[model samples]
Target: MIDILYFAWLRERIGHGRERLETTAPTVAALVEELRARDERHALAFADIAALRVAVDQELTDFDAPLKGAREVAFFPPMTGG
Candidate 1:
């Protein structure tokens, strides 16, 4: 199983902060597609991937990043300087 973490508005929209689940996705994008199929909350949280940033194993990466052997994934909006 892989741990998925949501931050900021993502967490608010999904109604939770994190989850652990087994998946057959080969890449982050594929995992997103699977999540979007789960329910309205997931779909809404993932509706605009362009507005989000992803981290695989705590390292920032593109959505096309491979998920092989990955233990965790995190999603959040891009950080901006104040």
Candidate 2:
């Protein structure tokens, strides 16, 4: 199982901050597809891939990044500079 963490609006949208998931996804994009299929809340949260930023094992990564042995994945909005 992998820990999936949602931050900010994502957390609110999904109605939770984190979850442990058991999935066969090979990449971040695949993992997203799995989550999006879960329910409306998940689908809506992942509706705009471009608006999201992902981290694997606490290190920023792209959606196409592999998830072979990742222990944690985090989703949040892109950081904006003032």
Candidate 3:
């Protein structure tokens, strides 16, 4: 099982902050596809992949990042500075 965390509007849209699930996805993008298939809330939250940033095990990574042995994955909007 892997811990999936959603932040900011993602959390709001998904109606929760985190979840733990077992998956056979090999990469973050594949995991996203699985999430999008789970429910409307998950689909909506991941609708725009370009608007999101991802982190694996607390380290920022791209959508194609491998999930082998990963324990946590986080999704959030890109940080902006004024």
Which of the numbered candidates is closest to the native, going by highest lDDT? Answer: 3
Please list the Cα RMSD from the true structure of every candidate, rounded to 1 decimal place: 0.4, 0.6, 0.4
Candidates ranked by lDDT, best first? 3, 1, 2
lDDT score at residue 43, model 2, on the 0-100 scale: 99
Badly placed stretches (over 4 Å) of model 1 are none
Worst 10 residues of 3 by lDDT: 40-49
Task: Please report the TM-score between candidate 1 and the true structure.
Answer: 0.99
Q: lDDT of candidate 2?
A: 0.98
Candidate 3 residue-wise lDDT, 7-81, digit = tens: 999999999999999999999999999999999999999999999999999999999999999999999999999
Q: If scored against the real structure, what TM-score would every candidate get?
A: 0.99, 0.98, 0.99
Q: Give candidate 3's total backbone clashes.
A: 0
What is the C-alpha lDDT profile of model 2 across 1-82, one tens digit per residue? Answer: 9999999999999999999989999999999999999999999999999999999999999999999999999999999999
Steric clash pairs (candidate 2) = none
Give the lDDT of residue 77 in candidate 1.
98
Model 1: clashing residue pairs? none
